[model samples]
Target chain A: MITSAAPALSRVHDVTEEVFAAIREVRDATVAALAPERPLVADLAALRPLLWSRLTTGPLAALIAGIGFIAAPGLLADAPWYLEWWQQHPSGQPRQLLRDLDPASSAFYDYTHWEWFTGPRVGRERTICGPYVDYLCTDEYSLTLSVPVTVGGAFAGAAAADVFVRNFEAAVAPALRELPKPAFLINAEGRVVASNSARWLSGSVYRGGLAVTPVPGLDLSLVQGPAAE
Target chain B: MVSSGARLAVFSPVDSTARVEAVVRRLADAIVLGLLTDGEQLPSEAELAARLGVSTVTLREALMALRQRGLVETRRGRGGGSFVRVPPDSGLEGRLRGLTVAELRDVSDHYAAIAGAAARLAAGRSLPSDLAPLRRSLDEMAGCPSPRLDGRFHIEVAAASQSARLTQEEIRLQADIGPLLWLSRDTPEGQDEMAKQHQAIVEAIERGDGDQARLVAERHVLDATDHLIELRLRLQD
Candidate 1:
């Protein structure tokens, strides 16, 4: 037992020493890699532009641009028309959306919209449609639709609105199904007649337009409202 | 392209010295930007000397300057060479304060959501192999009984999620939040609550209850946030 313990103790010491030495080696190597004589900076500088060019001018760029052009109308369709119109409007107040909508609700809507828009959709053919009855406000309504409206630019818009709505519903179905709350139905008037879970939305006044609640602790003022026309 | 006399002048020690300084500056910038990470061995001194077309002495001098900056450390032995130092945790307070309240809240919220998801996932999906290390971490936490250990416990869970980006972001955030957490750890209640939460999180993960795991992990982060907030408010008072 004594003889066994002696070797074990020595082995433990040896292991400890090895570990410390390894740590020292790692530290020294890290320090040397940081030496002033190293050519990493020049190499990285040369590499950066190559990466940037590849990202900006290569297939990746074209792919992104193609996707954007294809998806822009539908993606932008749900965006508040007043905001969209306002951007083109010579005398539009950018703050009108904020004024018309509750700041928190609008912000929440914007956040959720951003989340929903950026999220994956189920189909390429599904058109993007919005201005669906705003769950927040029953009296208010807005809609935007993006279809492959043009063979070139305007031709894709030839798809009927109902088709776009179907695609939008299809695209949004998975997320809606995953939602912990039951699907709430709103009529064209924008009233939430029934919902599965009503804790957050119940008793909250939803004007006919979509009402968005601000994320907790986020300041609504910093958020940009839809463009003013 | 230079005249013989001009070329001679350019090759003089003064010009050579200036060239060395420029090279050194470029190298320093690279290290700062993490083009070179800690523990990566440098090229041999002779190789570097030849590449730069400078005398070995000049290269040595540039290396020495870097050594003084605490960026590089040297070892002398048969197989020994220079290596980079682990950057010390510096400017931690300024970094924490640099975060906007909104940004901090967003990060906290994101951490909460993701950590919750990870806990739930770990509980529901963790294999027999996964439980051992997690159990080991719990054992270590129980043994160490330190706030630093507690922080490491949470960070380990984030790392266990197996997302490199998430792990890196968690480390950065942990570094930023280090001082505040350190200060909070001095309080008995803070220490006890943190430990309890950590144990609960581990248990939740063990049980394979995702919702419970998520809730526990989220509550743990929020508890830390609440403690930090209270500490800040107290200091102001």
Candidate 2:
């Protein structure tokens, strides 16, 4: 990392922070909604309108495709595990997403087994887990940011937000382009998230010599300047 | 039926030229696969064009082709917009017959490469939960035989590889030749065999056996190609 690129790298870092902040807001709301007691299915449904408004109107709105809560098994009074998720339609209306939850059914979406849910529950920390094709909420290449929702220190569920990779590229790539040397962003797994140059494709592993600059609080690093490809 | 994720993939921005044809095929595949329901209204032209990242002129041309194919109905006045009009059994045999044997083989080769590599990578990279959609597609095939069943299964497998590029390629190949290849799945025995093959692939992935997963996926595609080639020969005779 070069000393002069510090400002440019921070600009790129700010964009990521904005995304995490938006996801944290959703997580905070979800904790408040389930704090007193386990909410019935209807009570969970009631929180949709408020969450939808916040998602659509908040910062980085265009990049966000959806946001919701995924309950831990046996956390819901009526259902074993539940998803209070909502996805944005092209027509600008938000629709509640439904998936088969029966363990016997082949279509059952066992969210508890996914990285976004498990990372938070196991690590008890906010996590960012993607740049891979979502194939669930939005089929576009995406990143999911999640936080564990705890009730009195017991695991309850996770609150997560889906961000489109294309939009993230559009928003953050400009800052990356400002640097004198080629630069890219990589998540904890070393997969490229966004790059200023075409050499670093999203979802591909970065095996080049790494720069030492880390992006603020994220598990991401801003690799600036050149290294052996 | 096409998964909602696949439907969203179909609507993502077109990156290649021949935009008109690309748009036409995507919407046609959506309709035929039941991703777009019969009698459902489509978005306004501007909104749709924006979503697909295409110019209005290109969208109009594609819509014209769709209307000509009888896959869409354009009404005037109140609630006036294009609506999906799914044709009953859209000439599957005729479409299959249209392909030259050479063309069919070429497509099968390309599909096998993508599907095989996807299955292999998925076996190495995917979490156990990622196998749900593959099993779901197999269950759907066993319960009710349909052409879209196997195509969706392959797409789900590609998705599990966690590679967006491979997933996109799988979706494109499915749009191009999926219906023709899956035609044999309309038969009960064919459905059972197809389900078995898909199940083998799923089990291999669950067990994290990349070599086994790739072999099974490639063999399944080869067998389906042979079946389609035989059908083509019979039709020609």
Candidate 3:
């Protein structure tokens, strides 16, 4: 609601560029990974660990919670062909495992209706689904970044990566700890993903207020409260 | 810490035919905030009537009012009673967007107080395990496909405070104000800003910093209030 904050600040722009580039790496790697699979659109059940490993071997690892492809209808038996979620079962030794999604469950709550699915379908570009709970599937709050996975120029589905909300906040909190005033970041849906102040902190939504500045090149914005002066 | 049967403590039974609005408002708030889930059946008419301390006549009238607002629906025949039709403000944003800025500000102010106090108390009273849900809830908020879950974040924080009153008030506020805020639509930029703020609060509470928690909590609400005031000015302009 507060559009008062236009695109401003080079630092926000810098961070935005860095973040998007990392995402692009994820998308390109996914597309490339799919390209050599022979029947590229066939049940990609074997590629889960590869995709997870490829995406997490970078500076963005902590930010990632899961990665997978939600194949098109009749493509993967109505479920993601290969979904990889990070699991730390026996004390923080994180491991990647395939996410088992049942067809009956997937059918009940159509994926095509979800933001991560629809946003890419409509935009024909990579998109963000939510600061939302994938209530049935992931059950964790995440901002899923998804890009279309096409073979022979035909849309197969989406190659997506998730950033756990907790990871995002924990990573950024230290950097903002020194700021004298309240500042925060919000996703396109207006969900607050991170903040320096408690006012518009992570996990809350930012309605609107002063010092609103859009984080350039991303579907996000940065804002601070009014200046004391 | 989650006691399902605890809510009845907050509901005062209605005795007279005169307190219709009050009765309606209290019940309506419960529905909007998700103290009641979608399609969840209410207590039997007679049971509910007794519980609310109202005669069957007044209870019926309240149900009628709720039905008019699309918050509940009654079906005749077996296997049907008063089922929650709207299910915790399913249509919250749409309805809220139609409100004047003044009304929106008033609602936010009320929510802010409940939520801020809840955060402070949660910080004050809860153990580390109790505050753990903050992370989980924040994660849910990140990918929260709906506003109901987002609002539940505050309610959960209140619940962690271990104060029944704060928790109950939070449930009402989350239903009445939290989801409604999403109706107006915040920019992704604003959402990002808010997310960071949430993390700060969570960190403080985890550290058991009550004063800091209260300060942050109060600031969050005041800033939201300020936003509404600004929007109102723009409308007048």
Candidate 4:
């Protein structure tokens, strides 16, 4: 019986090698198809969809799915309140609104009278208030409150507002600070009005390249202020 | 005679298959260690079976076992037969995932030490060319608009050190720490602090200040470890 079965087993072994070879070819081709320029992380991302399919359709799929559910509890356990707030106010252009608000001074700005006005646009929440002492009120977006009021809330409302603003400022300040300040401005003439060190170092033409030349006889000084004249 | 043949067939013992499996394993090890060259044709089944003092069937079984190990391939047509094939190290991800937190911590320690050393070395060397890529990585990182890219920038920095072993180890470390980093990426405070730390490391590397680089890199990893611990505690609560 052993003799007879030995021959059959050998044949099975041969077949197994063939299948393995085919699998190897497939793997090589798949790896090669992922071009060298594609990063390892990108490769992982691409593999994830394939893996997901395998996990869903293969024998171990159920076990993996169960593990996924188990692992998800840690992720789903705590939803950050700030994230929720951000989502609710998606259009919350906090950076644009707080661009001029002094970080050190803004911490003390009063939020007691400040009301969080939900924007009509998705994901936007704006704080609204009437003008107060040391406050600059231009437009709704330009209403800069003093630092004292921000930290000077009477009760929990002030504390909550302070926390909310702090979170908002922290979220946006880094981005605004990193943005390259505009270097050169072309007035009416083709001459460069102003150039930042970055612009000078990089050598960028601000006014006229070949298309629309700078307007003739325009004042370059007018572009100096925060607002263009 | 017919009754006896039926009984023998029904109760046939295939225990010799274990011997075939053993041969397959040896061959696989040889292939993996580069003892066998890729595309090298293996001995014929008859030859192997004769060599092993087994029937051709058992030899075939051994070959099949090798195939399962990704060490060999077979062709069915004439002049087509078994050949050696090199398998990719696909087990890397699984191996990385299997690492315990303690193992990961060890890796983190090694990473910190090596990175600190590299920064110090680069600083002492003071070769502008050596520092160029580090600066470039930092610039790219600073320009990145998303937190995901920000995390990737650090990983890229580790990889750009030009040490394959270090890169591989760092990749494993990244996998171990990835989920936690992903969780923290959305937090404003977390993101800001992380970006600042990353910038500090880059600046130090650029300035050829090894001590600063070492301090920054070590602090970054330690801070991340602390954050993860804090997060775990929060979750426990």
> Which is superior by TM-score, 1 or 4?
1
Q: Write the per-residue lDDT of candidate 4 for residues B21-139, one digit (tens) a residue.
A: 65665465456435577899988887655444456777788887778867789998988989998766422232233445565566557657755654454343323333444455456
Query: Please, what are the lDDT tens digits per residue for candidate 2 over residues B76-171?
Result: 999799999977655556567668788888988998999999999888766634676677677776786655556667888998887777898898
Model 3 alpha-carbon drift over 4 Å, by segment: A1-26, A32-46, A54-58, A76-109, B1-237
Every model's DockQ: 0.01, 0.12, 0.01, 0.01
Question: What is the fnat value (0 to 1) for candidate 2?
Answer: 0.16
Q: Residues A1-229, candidate 4, lDDT per residue (tens digit)? A: 1112223223323322332333233233334333444223223223222323322343322211110000001111221010000000122111101111221212212222222211111212122111111111111111111111011121101100112222222332333223234323332222222233243211112333222322122122111212111
Give lDDT tens digits, candidate 2, residues A1-229. 5446667667767877776677677777777778557577666755665556644564666777888888888887877757888777664556566544543322225566567888889955768878767765566789888888888888888888888888888888777777654688888767778887777766655666757467777788877655434
Score candidate 4 by DockQ: 0.01
The candidate, 2 or 4, that scores higher on lDDT is: 2
TM-score of each: 0.32, 0.61, 0.43, 0.28
lDDT of 1 at B34: 51
* Regions more than 4 Å wrong, model 1: A1-229, B1-100, B146-148, B159-168, B234-237
Winning model by lDDT: 2
In the range A92-200, model 3's lDDT, one tens digit per residue, is: 2334442223333121134565567777666447476556544435456566777776666777677666776777667666555544457677776566667777666
C-alpha lDDT score of every prediction, in listed order: 0.41, 0.75, 0.59, 0.38
Docking class of 3: incorrect
- List RMSD in Å for every model shown: 26.0, 10.8, 18.8, 30.4
